[model samples]
Target: MDPTGNVGLLKCIYNIWKKPSKKAIIIYRWAKKMHDKNYKHIPIFLTNKLVVNYGSFISLNANIGRNLDFRHINGIVIGDGVTIANNVVIYQQVTLGGKNLGDFQKGNYPSIEDGVTIFAGAKIIGNITVGANSIVGANSVVINDVPANSVVAGIPAKVVKKLSY
Candidate 1:
């Protein structure tokens, strides 16, 4: 029947079958929708348990945009108060979290702008902004704000190259 070629429900189901990451994200989206509508309990379970079963921990409190792509579903953590924009690709073992776990204050999370790609095992901590079209290299520890259209790497990441376009 070529479900992948079909539109609407068929395509969605095909994607869920083909991609593990998509399956997890779909569950997250469903839970997030319920959370936004003030339907508690279920959303919490869905996010904490079901998503965790897939090996990802994405807080429902985080603000996320469209076209969020998780290349590898496992070992990804998106902390509360974090903001992620459209078309962001996050690989496995990537953590977008606060620097201080002791500080339970609001707005301590990082903000990821559109078209950002965070590679595997990268830890982006604190209340910094990862600008649009930026790429964070694998195993990098980013503490400072990244400018738009830049490529960063290494511990406490620094701009390695400035991208054009």
Candidate 2:
């Protein structure tokens, strides 16, 4: 079989075998693939298992792009309708979720663009867009939109510095 065609399958198997800290991503990928293929029940079962095993709760409805890397996988919660682009790295205890308890407003979850890095203990809530190549510091609370190529830190996450291309 062609390697590129089976990349996801291969990666999932390998990650599970290696038992990496971010093995949950591979599991999520498999669940997402099953979900996309209309294999609903299996995905739900697998995701629930992953939540219990990995301590990472990723919604089946979350839209994620390729090459997502996790530094520490514990306590990572990604809510429904949240969008994460390619080459994004997320650390432990990060929450990308909505503001309210009940049903989320349309487009109310956080959108993480390409090349974004979210540090440990960061809580990115509400309908906000974290731009490409930006860095969210540890323990920061992001309630507003972050500009591209910027480094944000502290409570409410102010732009500490703008990165150059």
In TM-score terms, which candidate is top?
1
Would you estimate the TM-scores of all the predictions?
A: 0.90, 0.87
**CA RMSD (A), model 1:** 2.7
What does candidate 1's lDDT look like per residue over 41-116, in tens digits?
A: 9998888775557778998888999999999988999988889999999999999998787433757889999999
Clashes per candidate (backbone, < 3 Å): 0, 0
Error of 1 at 1 (Å): 6.5
In terms of lDDT, the poorest run of 10 residues in model 2 is: 14-23
- Candidate 2 at residue 49, lDDT? 80
TM-score of model number 1:
0.90
List, residue by residue over 42-148, the lDDT tens digit for candidate 2: 89998898788878899989999998988888889999979999999999999999998743557789999999999999999999999999999999999999999
For model 2, the local distance difference test gives 0.90
In model 2, residue pairs whose N, Cα or C atoms come closer than 3 Å (at least 3 residues apart or on different chains), thus clashing, are none
